[model samples]
Target: MVRCYKCGRKMKYIRGLKFNQYAVDGWKCGDCGEVYYDADQAQRILLLNKLKKQKFRLKLNQVRSNLILRIPKEVGEAMGLRNGSEIEFSLKDDDKIIIST
Candidate 1:
């Protein structure tokens, strides 16, 4: 709910525009052509964030049907004590969450 820099009016929400990594900070005014928070540090940080987000879908390939997990032995020992014990699992949010049975 920030105001536009040029017009001093509330900014309108217009998504889908991508940043140039060094050319964006805060947001732009649709009514006026002014960019919000026009500072070099802010713009560079926004660009770094944009780069991190862009890296999300940039992976080309992944392994199929194989999952791997590495766990500490002390946690397993405290939970129950077995090599082949049964376990239950469910997803919370987007990760494969585990529950001990």
Candidate 2:
């Protein structure tokens, strides 16, 4: 059991606590309503927050009979994507697509 640093009250473990729409396990202080995450959870949340700050506008071009999408240099470098790198594409929803390497 974890104790709250502020109120010195026993903290309760909360599963699937929402942080920026991401679910993370956290400890909540009942007395002060303070939430805390473990090291792994905190790192994951930080990475997710960093990714949320990156936004790019790209243009779609038409080839002979196919559509071509160009990735910006910064985006590619950040993602560690290289020329001829294999990536997977999937439909996340009706309007969103997920690309993973």
* Whole-model Cα lDDT of every candidate shown, in order: 0.55, 0.82
Model 2 per-residue lDDT tens digits across residues 5-93? 99999999999887867788989998899999766876766765676688867799999999878988766665668999989989999
Q: What is the Cα-based TM-score of model 1?
A: 0.31
Let me know the TM-score candidate 2 reaches against the reference structure.
0.52
Among these predictions, the greatest TM-score belongs to 2
How many clashes in each candidate?
0, 0
The TM-scores, one per candidate, come to: 0.31, 0.52
lDDT score for residue 17 of model 1: 37
Which one wins on lDDT?
2
Worst 10 residues of 1 by lDDT: 53-62
Writing each residue's lDDT as its tens digit, candidate 1 over 1-100 gives: 8788669977654443345534334566777866655455455555445444542222234358656453445444444548777777677677546455
Off by over 4 Å in 1: 1-64
